[model samples]
Target: MSQTINYQAQSPTHEIESKPFDEKNQVEHVNDVSAAKELSNFKMDAMEAEKAEHNMTVLEAVKAYPWACFWAFVMSFTIIMESYDVFLIGNFLALDEFKRQFGILDHNTGKLVIAAKWQSALQMAGQLGALIGVFLAGPLTSKIGYRWATIVALIAMNATIFVMYFADSLPIFFVAQLLEGLPWGIFIANAPAYCSEIVPIKLRAPATQVLQMFWAIGSIIVGAVTYHYNPMSGKKAYRIPIALQWMFPTPLLVLMFLAPESPWWLVRKGRLEEAAKSVNRLGRKSRLNANEIVAMMRRVVENEKEGSISYLELFKMPDLRRTLIVSGVYAAQNLTGNLIANQAVYFFQQAGMSDQTAFALGLITSALQMIFVMLSWILTSYYGRRPIYIWGTAFNTVMLFALGIAASVGKSNAASQAQASFGLIVSVMFTFAAAPVGYAIIGETGSIRLRPLTTGFGRAVYYIVEIPCIFLASYMLNPTGANLGGKCGYVWGGTATVCLILAYFFLPEMKGRSYRELDILFHRRVPARQFSKTVIGPEEDE
Candidate 1:
């Protein structure tokens, strides 16, 4: 990527203009060494740099850009706390002290518990807040840049933690969660895009997948922490875990200040000098040619410079398809039944397991999810996203169906065990394929011009989908409600089946392709299945 060359296609007389040039000539010189005279006389210096980066082996790219990889991982740490907070509230409902503080007496179950309506309300409160946060993240990060935007969010998240820690009632806790969602939204939506930008093309998927790993890691910690505190009888039980959440942002905050800024974001703003410096910091070891790489980024920025920069643009032409694809990718995870698996502690408790077993199973399930997410790094590399995502959805369909069958076998211990086992299996399949892949795709799918904003719109779709699912789960799991237990599997199973069909028709393979290649393919409106075989350039390099 460091090498520079002269473009014989002499267009020195052509005035500099910011418009989407002919896509046909975009890659003409990139991989061609023949006498195919380049088009328009415009030098392919930028395309050449990008081609070099794209042609790199995974190992070559990693060794060359170690600091970029390091910062990507570090920036993703914010997700750990975000995940922790998400699970903490659901599990807390099962704690003795939490029940006393927030639960209403349930005559049917003859026990104290948070009402189903309240449970769904609490979950939605956070989702509503996150939706608002996602809306802000795109513009906020765009204007201020990732580093400062993150600093602002971390500080805001810490401030919200105080409210969660001191809350003595359900209403107060609800407000706290709702408020906390603002920053959590910022972190979740922006983290993947930031990570995607810092790493080289070969490492992009793996880097974005790290966000899911951190999410599983966060869930595991919350499970262990919540399980250990399950024996407590007072407010300390819940407060201690909430207090630990405050610690996540501090270390992440420090790392944010210390990490290199995203070179892509810098280039988008026409700040080449800053972008070059950022690139040098990220890949100094490999001797990255900042001038060439910056030009490469500039071309990408130039091509996407069409349309006024606004959310409305996201719904227009090429970007609309990009928007729908990303939105579908995000929504697919929820359809696969993450809401239940994510809160296995609460899901298990309602399914007839004792509190201790419920917590233990939740921990084990979370640990398994983490392990599978680790496995995803390998699967994604070999199988690419299209197959893994489709296969995972198919597997989800079967496992959720089996879970429903087990639940319908009646309330026997064996039936309960069968339901629990299937839930774990479903979670395993999800993390290995559906769950992790969504994070990666969100990073890769959108146009660079409006990535964060598009991601926000996509996440908004997720919360919109989840809102109905939350209400459904509340009705199904609530003792005062249907108390369907594992029978709820039928609902998610149906959703997974729908998602599978949709993915088959819509999802495309983007395994080793660069953004420029992808841009050409999408512009031509190629078939989704033809993505891998339909070559863009005449002699596109491997």
Candidate 2:
């Protein structure tokens, strides 16, 4: 625990001259009184809370102070990297010669190959590593705190990236992947929750979207790099890009230590004075009061007492259980064909395009994905979650269905070429609609008490499902198979379309509400999705 020093406001040292008794001095005194009132208002928590109650705009708060923009920018480095990691594999795999050289060749014909089962086994191993790391997030945040937890995850992830460059065989490569996955998971789940807690409530949703925007930008940049460089061309092959991934986490490790622990987390741990000091530093205003600090502390403490702290207890309550289940269902977003479309650049090659050409196409598709993600960020607060969730999923499903139909009917050399181009466009549409909003929906589905647990569970489930889905797509699209690429695209598109339709009816709209309000939602007697439109009594609303 940080030691807290008592704060005392400093006064001017010089004594006033006798001439201060004049009318000029009287005017100065009135001005001083007005300044004090303004400072007092700035320190008042109730006034800020009231502003939120009236639905105070995020733009108004950010405009009132520009430094919030700096923090948003700094935070973007971590999230953009998260976005990059999510999609980097897509372009890298698209390199045709790269896959051939790596020994992932025609069925039973490769020299340096790990069996498909082993490749997928490696994927599962990586997912398991992530699950274990995610399980530690809350307690680690509680112990050394959020900033340090971020630093630890950063260091571990970057180190794993460096080690990855040395791997020559499947086992060594798989181990590196497993190690890398551990901390990337930590960065993904904790970074948003950390950013959300530190900023003003009004800026919370936008800040989350800002993080998402960085993610989109990062993905686009990586896609562009791999596309243009054609990472598989020379002797360097995939090694150069694989080594470059480490660069994302290296600088962030140093920056994490410079940042402060979350004030909300500190306050919940009975370190109110330290929380106040941290909050004051974050706001860059030295005059924040102890009373205002105490109010925020009290709110977190009340939540800590009432909510589940253990992983088991998180699943015990009916409402919390439903919330977890609802959140987990969106795990399908990660599992359903989106990732296969996003990550299967190599498989697309079997469909017909050359590796370099496939990556060039991927570069265009990723740009579209980024643009739509930016649009989702802007509309999330204004249009609300339910409509976006419904439409985004619905539209993505339609695109997937089209891709499936196009692939199913196409067969010869010319027809296969046409279907490949058509499938690529439809896949881009799927990513634009589904890939960006997946995190937003997860971010909104639960209260702080159950938030980390639910996120961890959902992420674990996503990866678990992803391991099989990825390899299955790879297997079906193996270069030796007849109508290779067409078959995999058809299967993935059809399955994902079904999962998305189910989600439209089940996912709740979490737009424009406080974290505290989410508890009331899960605790309600009605079904989880209905909570979006149902009005509660005044006492229940409280």
Candidate 3:
């Protein structure tokens, strides 16, 4: 004889009543149906409870996790070195001193310019090293942990800066650039993951945006330093900026030593005790429940372990879709005219602006980008990720098209060239809104067990995509090659259109979803548009 069981399903919005199941008197068919209904109701109640625990207003999360925010700000300083390096190289191209040191004299124009091959090589070498660094970050971090990996990378970057400072020849400088990229590769690949994991769900997007904001600040500083120093003759102009790179890494190295290792990473290594301690350490100011956080982390880990996904599995079926989205979004950001726009000083000089004017404009551009990135933090925190990417892409597409039109029509006139330059600046501003969000999304999208590997793979894909895109951009913008000038916008504008469509169709609303929630949503094959409306809990199985 079977006994009756009553079940209740409670949802945040409403409660569902399940009738009692009676097996002794009822037919087997009726009993079985009742039993199934009761089981489903119980699962629903568990899901609702899980979701409620994880949900918090953004303000509440911030007030709770102030220390987490402070740590994220500290970690974000890593990107300043990266942005400084990028802008220093571009601004140096317009510097007479930089040209004298590494460039060949253009007899026709009586000016010095870096040879096209050398320029491309200088750019590609760093990217190549970065590619290797990103690929290696997974194993390194998994073995030694994120904090140690960062320290090692920071030390390597300092060594490379010293090499760049003393080098008299381009070959040595090129090698230094390449070697330095390894640390940047590791830092960029892992910093977002570190930031995302430490913060509460509501603060994740804002915390990640902090990295890009510092990137802009670094760019601005480089522009100012180059503007003042580049006019002076000799290697000192370039060396001063290169030397300043040490300022960020040195202090960062000290702080990282004191920083807590990621609790999630600790959990992944079966160091639950340490992970719990870390959760408390990191979330101490937030007053978060350390035990509850650890339990939730354990559930996520157990779920992932049950799946037993291999690295190769990342390229197969469900996981492959995620990899593609993560990689594709990163790759798409490059194609949005950032490569060409980043070389703003060079492009402006090519358009006939005086060197001083070009550098000043570049400084303004960086400042504007910094402002916009801060605004993006607010917008993303309030509005969600998908809308920003959608509208930002649309805005960029139109600006690029208009800039291309402006350049083509007024290529010969200073007024038209200025218009084209202004258009590029505006386009870059729009990009800031969307590009930073991609970093957050990449960190959020990967499975916890496979995150390091998947993000590494995604970053590798990003660099690979950037190689050709950078090469093409260098050719089109460099005077020795196609010299499309602003007309190059046509190429990027078309690519942006395609990326916008892909984002609309494929990128889900990961706005406030936790990693565990995202895992269940992906495993269940929820449509991208339905992510926000869909409620998920730990009880939901793949």
Candidate 4:
């Protein structure tokens, strides 16, 4: 906590001439008279409660919010399936069994390869399907709530899992990926929002970030399974991986049925009693009062003038800024060369590593990604979201350029080895930096009333950005196509440079802020960098 600095307004026109930098306690004082006029007694109570809740140490939070932690994890568990299959698509290209079944023989290289157009198409199909699903998730989640929406999505996912399990041809597999993208879209959007809504301010970062950890875990599972099966012949190699996706939906469906609906969602829908009950369940060990927290949730929903929960609201004044920031940061995920990293098994091979080495390196990097995601939670606890993403993207940009240099130096054994090392390093760096933190930022950046829509729209933006990214990755990495191999890093490095600039300007510090404080800061039009330093103690709505 910084010194207890106060904001005394000399007049209505007098601005806050001096500001104190407080990263952990963004709203420590409530002395600006004009700002005070914005704070009702109820709002002040809400802010104070938020401050105390956010001030909880990680241990205190873990002890107090066990239910929140558990249910949020349960809600996100199914995302592992999405990541598993998404990982499989890229890694399978390197598997002889999958290639024999699905890929055409490439005469040019004497290798079996999934054609570049089809590779791009298959990836784009998922993103396109996901884009449609993302927009649909907004209204569906708003109507039925996150838990039920997830339940519905799980049912849809189960059907698609069967499609994937039995797919024998490329066309059928494409259709399966496209359809499965729907629930994956719903899961990605819903998990972060659910985690953010259920947990206290202190737990929100780690909770939302768990999505990335799950993705890494999913990748690890696929890597391990595929590596074991790589030596096997015929359909079992690819089919075993597809069959395993069935493991996700059923278990997660049971967990979802047992989980609590988001209290914030309940409050927004005017189910105060249910919201309070959900809050009580989630916060059974907390020292705070559920009723007071419900009131705060109510105030926050109303303060955003949330009547317009539709997508259009996202394009309006304050909400528009939040939407853009959320969209840009999410877009940055793709721009930072995720395709190169995510498809490292195939990518490393083309850069000259042996198939065995490629598989081993991919598995090693997936494990590292999972480990780094946990480490990122520690970084998130100590640093603000802006710095993590900005610096993370910056670090990734440098690594991308380095990878390009290694590839440009020629595919000598040492150069190929350097390329392989840098590719994995980029993946690990991205995992530590922007990857996990992006989840927390999106959940916190949007308006409370439009939280679902905001996250959905942001994800929609990602898929939109992903379409070209997938196409580029397919063409650049496919030996049958441009086959740029490691040289592809130069292209993504340029994009990452752009992403770094956007994040520095648009990303705000959402590390320690409650929904209420964030709503005020955005409404006040505080610059992105000033979010941590500018104090706006609980403020009233106009």
Predicted candidate 1 versus true structure: per-residue lDDT over 211-319, tens digit per residue: 9889889989998998898898788988999999877888888989988789889888888899989988888645577777877777677766477667898988788
Residue-level error in angstroms, candidate 3, position 473: 1.1
Question: Which of 1 and 3 is the better model by TM-score?
Answer: 1
**Where is the poorest 10-residue window by lDDT in model 4?**
1-10
Model 4 CA RMSD to the hidden true structure, in angstroms: 12.7
Runs in model 3 deviating more than 4 A are 1-53, 305-310, 412-420, 537-539
Could you tell me which 10 consecutive residues in candidate 2 have the lowest summed lDDT? 6-15
RMSD of 1: 9.7
User: Which residue pairs does candidate 2 place in steric collision?
Assistant: 93-346, 94-345
Please provide TM-scores, in order, for all candidate models, with all chains considered together: 0.91, 0.80, 0.88, 0.91
TM-score of 1: 0.91
Which candidate has the top score in lDDT?
A: 4
User: Tens digits of per-residue lDDT for model 4 on 320-369?
Assistant: 99999889878888989677768889888988988888999999999999
lDDT of 2 by residue, 1-542 (tens): 12332222212222244445666888998999999986555435533443343354767656542454455556556766555655654444444434455555445545333345554455455556676677777566556666787788888776777666787666676787678777866766676666666666555655655655675577677777677566446636667767677667767777667776667677667787787777665664532444564554455346443654666755666445545554555466654556545554554565566667666666666676657667776776677656766576666555555655656675666765665665666555555455545666665554555555566666666766676676675566544433355555556656766666666656666666555455566665456478667764322323
Per-residue error (Å), model 4, residue 20: 58
lDDT of each: 0.83, 0.60, 0.78, 0.85
Which pairs in model 1 have colliding backbones?
Answer: 9-41
